[model samples]
Target: MTPRSRPTAGGSTALPGTDFGHLTESTRPLVELDDAARIRSIRSERWIGYPQARSVLGHLETLLSWPDRQRMPNLLLLGSTNNGKSMIIEKFRRTHPPTSLSDREQIPVLCVQMPPEPSPSRFYLAVLAALGTPIRPHSRVPDLERQALMLLRATKVRMLIVDELHNVLAGRDNARREFLNMLRFLGNDLRIPLVGVGTRDAYLAIRTDPQLENRFAPMTLPTWTNTPQARSLMASFAASYPLRQPSHLASPEMTDYLLTRCEGTIGELSTLLTSAAVLAVDTGAEAITPGVLERTEYLGPTERRRQFERHLP
Candidate 1:
């Protein structure tokens, strides 16, 4: 009899063959818990598929299925930090995760982070690492390029997703140009869709090369505002929390309060809700309320930074 190997997610043992599916380790174990335990369970990280994200995911599915063409289709997912860009990409990846085919594991989508500084060496290294390909640290550009290209093709990667593409904005002009050229060359060489996820600067980065910009269509996820859809988003999100009573998180005052606390980003909003829920659990409230929100450790980005900055003199 052969033993089965379990997967690791966030360092916890996961069921064999489980691909870290949408339900995170944080929220998966509370299938039948009371409100208090549910609050703690609901505090886990989760995916909230708002309208824009669902539409973007649908477009990504189309791109992945696109037949190979001279000018391969690509996407530039532009949005503010913590506005759910990465989450959308992550959901897409999970949907088309690696699968074994004819003894070869085919990674339909490959997601990698753009390096802090844009350099060909770093770019190749990141790709190689994603593929779990070991390499000599001092390998030359040509060797690394050949190695990366071979692995990408062998893995049958249909889509390459690069997150935090705005990091390229930090590189110098020559490096930036080279990086953009590399992107164009890769699409031409591999005939695979390239999905770039980053802040709005990522669109600007792609635009630097008119040809690349033309090849990749732009998709934007704007910051949240007080709207019916936004309120609905809040309500849908709040329903998932384990609370004794309905939170009414989308009520006028609550909506404004959450928006301000989240700094208008869905990611921050999610974190704030998690924190508030957890605090409520600790305090026996079991529901998110203005009092619970006030007691939460959650802090908006600007305010959090301001706190640290104030003590630095």
Candidate 2:
């Protein structure tokens, strides 16, 4: 056969019928899958689809409505790492926008994640920054507190949701005491309910401050353990991913596999399911399958597992 003539440097060799409009969808990077939209999916049943989620939301609503209840109960949410604490708060924020709450009420739920072993001054600065208050990078602790209080007053934040409350106890005794005192003031002085969320250690930290303990209503939300609710949650999770494995949809075997892999934590399960979906999409599969999930190893090594275990049930 005669060789096809090669186009010169500037000449076009493109196919005559090529249409740029029909470009195939590119594969989305797995890392990019952790964006706010996908991870904060409230529609996913397998993860946030648990019965306890409603209970938590209801408790939050109660606090919002009865902010004046002299008791001013603080909520203590304890669970294992990867236990859906963050997701629950994210979903709550999505469904009940903070802007709406701030307009109608003072001390609306202000969700904040505490830094690991942060100082009282650092904590105050973080709160101020989170509330969008002006703060000098080198400003003094007292200045930050003044600004924070002003922002709180301006925003009308009724309740504060402090995630990873265990951080308060990570500091020195003086630091810990100061943090606790700040919490006391945020609750008693401002009369705003402080909802602290963390792993099991959060419970232990509260014990250090009896006053905080007195004001707090400890609510433990553990990972599912061989229950009907767990299966139902899995079904919901499967529904959220349009490309979820066909075998996993409401299947007992898939539920068991998910439970075993994620160790009953809806958060971990969601992460795994998302990974599996991305993998399926990359491999040109229309749906996720048991094989695809098994092929995608999302969990970490033994050392990482130990780190996660420290925050477990």
Candidate 3:
């Protein structure tokens, strides 16, 4: 009697006629999750249809379209979370490529996400890294800052998008002073538009640095208020994902439930919806249902409690 090879749980044996490599690849996990961070995209299609989102994009476009003779004004994007702030910046870059014709006129959008804890040295290094510069292992704060500015000048970048400006506070009093000096130096000395983006705290951060604050005019991105605009945003979300289709989520009740749960934050909304879609795909459901949404464990304890309380009698 010939011994039989054992088949894997999915039924096909690896040592036999089946192409195991192809089978394993086909059966690979659907939604890729890493260290509690959901890797969802923030693009127009994913953005809940908010007119303000479009407005923000238009504002950035105007900033980028400054004529040859003038200096681009510094812009401050101040808003609470999920107000489509980052989306606007990204969309602007996509719709309008930042490149100048001549070397002196060359334009580049340098986006740097500020760290939770920031110092002068850290800030300089972070900015340089964001600009794709090679950071020397033993470089000092001043060295990095000098190199960053030199590269910025050499590249002639028109706009510097500093996301999470609140991180400058991660330093000591002296560090903060030095960091603000860098901003002042960049604004007055370099003649490039420096756009700062962060939560409401970002506004306060800029306000503290009088020189930096004076250089930037603040623009606020408003959160959805459950008004007609909210409905329009929901409609936009529907259009983007097309819940009615078999290959996606389709529960109207779940959609309303999501809005209630997320409180109309674009980032939270996108995150929740994307998660639900992924859950549906995982469970072999062609359309998302209330049951699937209920089964999700991604919502934080506080958020879930709020959601539960709101729905309760």
Candidate 4:
């Protein structure tokens, strides 16, 4: 067969290419799958792109089009733990997957997790690895930095996303200052937007340096509440659960239980629904109800954090 006419792998399209157009604009992809495929889809990790997530994506898209950068604008996306910050950024990244250029990939958006402790060398290492260009195994800091910056340019990276930026705060004061300075230099050097994503502590970190603080416009994903938007988001999520019966998650009783159990965070809410959906499938119930949720063993973020804190000292 001609290369252009290569057959799809074993014709096994259990997922993808389904008529998911009926789903809400954000979740329409889920509508394409049959029940079994939908159940499998729910089990895997995915991005929901809720309202807050969409807003962040819009901000990043705007930044991508900014002209030659002097005083380039940056973004700081901060929110509570499990409030969907990473998901938002990841969704944006997926929407712009890498493209093949002349014998190399032109990664428009390069994202890396901030090291648990801040160090310029470690930051460079993360970026280099993400770009598939590892520095020498035992290279010095300056060498790693040089290679990373060069590759970031060569690959035409339009945006640099450092998730878990708050981790810098765990390092010493001087280290934090150095990391922030490195970020400033990187932004100025690359002339691309630098997006920082983490909990509220990330805002505190960025605020330490007046220059850095001034550059990043802040966007926060506040905890969800019992509002129409929140209910709509929940409903959108439940619609993808693959259950035969509607979960009616937006009903006041169900919504309150879900919010209370999920601690009003999108990540937790998603996990809870996914877990309940999987269990429903296993039990042959084919639907999520208050009884199913009650039987699920998932714990809310607050309770889980409390449990960990109690064991300390």
Comparing 1 and 3 on lDDT, the stronger one: 1
- Overall lDDT per candidate, in order of appearance: 0.82, 0.68, 0.63, 0.81
Candidate 2's residue-wise lDDT over 1-313, tens digit each?
Answer: 1112344344422223323221112212211232233334323443344789889988878877783755687889888887888778777766666554524433356788797775767788778767766678788878877788878877877778899988777888887887888888778767777889998888887888888888889887887766778777766655555331232545667777777777777677777777776666566453567778778868733436798989998
Clashing pairs in 3: 118-170, 249-288
TM-score of 1: 0.87
Clashes of 3: 2
Ranking, lDDT, top scorer first: 1, 4, 2, 3
Q: Which candidate gets the maximum TM-score versus the true structure?
A: 1
Which of the two candidates, 2 or 4, achieves a greater lDDT against the reference?
A: 4
Predicted structure with the largest lDDT when compared to the true one: 1
Q: For candidate 1, what is the lDDT?
A: 0.82
Pairs with backbone N, CA or C atoms under 3 Å apart (clashes), candidate 4: 18-32, 19-32, 20-31, 20-32
lDDT of 4 by residue, 159-192 (tens): 9999999998999999999999999999998999
Q: Which parts of model 2 have CA positions greater than 4 angstroms off?
A: 1-47, 67-69, 100-107, 300-313
Q: Higher-lDDT candidate among 1 and 2?
A: 1
Clashes of 1: 0
